[model samples]
Target: MYENYAQRLAVVYEATHKPEDFISADFEFKKMMRAGSCSAEDLRCYGILHHQMACYCIDKAVDLFDKVIGQGKAVDKDVFWRTKHQKMILYSQTGKAQKNIDEALAVINDGSEDAEDWICLIAAYSYSGDAAKAYEWILKAIPKFPDKAALYVYGGDTCRDLKKYDEAFKYWRKALELDDKMYDARYSMGFCYEELEEYGKAYDIWLDIARDLEEDGYEIEKQFPMELAEKCKAVLTDHPA
Candidate 1:
């Protein structure tokens, strides 16, 4: 049953990493679907593989997902939710973020589960530059995962994007409260402070990230800290205390 499927997939193996070969994964997935003996792992694999394809070929990926769903197999619940979320990602990738956000809102309204799903839903709205809707969904999702540092960090970034500096600061501070070692959150706080012209505060926060990165045995240049440190120095130089 899978003979033809496997053969066709082999044709595209060499093209996998080529930037010009868009839909390479989809080409492979088509073979898998044709196998007719898929298992739950196959369904999950199909979901993720198509999702990666959806990043480059939304329509084809969506079709692949539809095919996977039609296979009548029991997909893992997490994979199921992620696949559904990938539908929203497909809309976003196709420049229909608002439409996906509207649909996601409807889905949540109809009682969807999973904090991560809600995170992606809010991200869809945010990607479309709709900060208000993003904020709304994030606000709703936060309570469900109150201690999750990532949620606060995401919320803070959204607020920063909206220029809601105070709100951004509040969220970043909350994230630090939950996990003080989150260097990125500390860096983000610096960004918010910088935007607010609170250079002293920004410098202080950047220094904090720098110190933490050093302690982790990672070079400050290994990530974003070095640039941030330079920025802090520049700010202090221009506005000397």
Candidate 2:
């Protein structure tokens, strides 16, 4: 098990392309377990190693969790939760949407209020078509972590899905207030303005977003606000006054 640890650690640090990392890590993890040279202490070590390996492949992580649990080696509770959480992430990434929702809900049922747990719960709800509950959770999270811009973005998305445009605008603008450099907030506000039929205001805000993105070298001109700004320009051209 220790033999695979070095290679797995290297792949994890190079997080840019993940499929390659997962394959290598999974191979090494399985190789160690199959080699059967592990000591009694190797059980605990394997638990930690498997948990990290799961970051590359959730199925392999699940297998490792089973191995740990079966070993009865008395690993940490945090590691257990982390293993479960990684499995949920894998479920989500692999498009097993309901599985993600169910597993994340299981985490919350365990009475853990850590940021990872709540964020995963929120994501599961959003992905599983429960925008109302997702909004409720974000409301709770906002007071819990007032400085987190993700809560605001999630609130805005939930409100928009529910057709509460004004509330959506309020949340997006709140996100901007919390982090003026929030690129999505600027683009989302431009969208909210468009939905409210405030075309001139929308155009101006989108143009501002385009300029900000350009300054940041973000290639934003091909994305939301910039794209919309280009469309608005086309419309304005046909109706030039």
Candidate 3:
């Protein structure tokens, strides 16, 4: 069945969110889909494949998610709730605060308690220019799921965006403590240092992140840390710091 191909694509997606990987997955998915074998599972994978930073991808993902939501009883209860949750996340990326909040509220009540729900709800508030609410919720969430490194990374993001650099630093440090391999939190810390004009500190963190990425088998040449490291090095070379 086409669901088999869709399952394979889902595995690849979980492994890496690289656009190239999605392109490769799309090839197989299309072959199966065009054969008149498309299933609800295939549709879900298709939606996930297009969920990225591109504007077109966001619109397409939302449409696909909406279609999947309309499937109602055809989908499992849990899968249906997760689908709604994902749609809420994509809506937050649309840059509409009220709409994002409404979608977020709907999904949380749709019955699937997950760490992702808390983080996405926090993100909805943060990206919607309501960092105060995001901050309030993060404080509440950490005590409940203290070891969720992803939550801390998102909390760091909210603090950084609010110009609370020190609080952001605390959040990132806690995140790294929980998951030493959390390069996202490390990058956030590096960005904060750069924002504070601490070129030397930023340079060191960037170099560390580059090494971490390489250790994780990522190509440093294609990674953002190396790019940041190069830029920070140039700043240090000129300023002697």
**Using TM-score as the measure, which candidate wins?**
3
lDDT of 1 at 97: 80
Model 3 lDDT per residue over 85-134, tens place: 67766666665667877666676779546666677678778767888998
Q: Count the backbone clashes (under 3 Å) in each candidate.
A: 0, 0, 0
Q: Estimate each model's TM-score.
A: 0.57, 0.56, 0.64
List per-prediction Cα lDDT, in the order shown. Answer: 0.71, 0.71, 0.78
lDDT for model 3, please.
0.78
Please say which candidate is ahead in lDDT: 2 or 3: 3
Q: Poorest 10 consecutive residues of model 1 by lDDT?
A: 1-10
Candidate 1 per-residue lDDT over residues 113-187, each given as its tens digit? 757657777877877777887888788889888987877888998999988887897888899999989766887
Can you tell me which runs of candidate 1 are displaced by over 4 Å? Answer: 1-96, 99-110, 220-223
Evaluate model 2: give its TM-score: 0.56
- In candidate 2 the C-alpha lDDT for residue 205 amounts to 88
> Residue-wise lDDT of candidate 2 within 70-98, one digit each (tens)?
54425765576556555555666667878
| Residue 164's lDDT in candidate 2 | 87
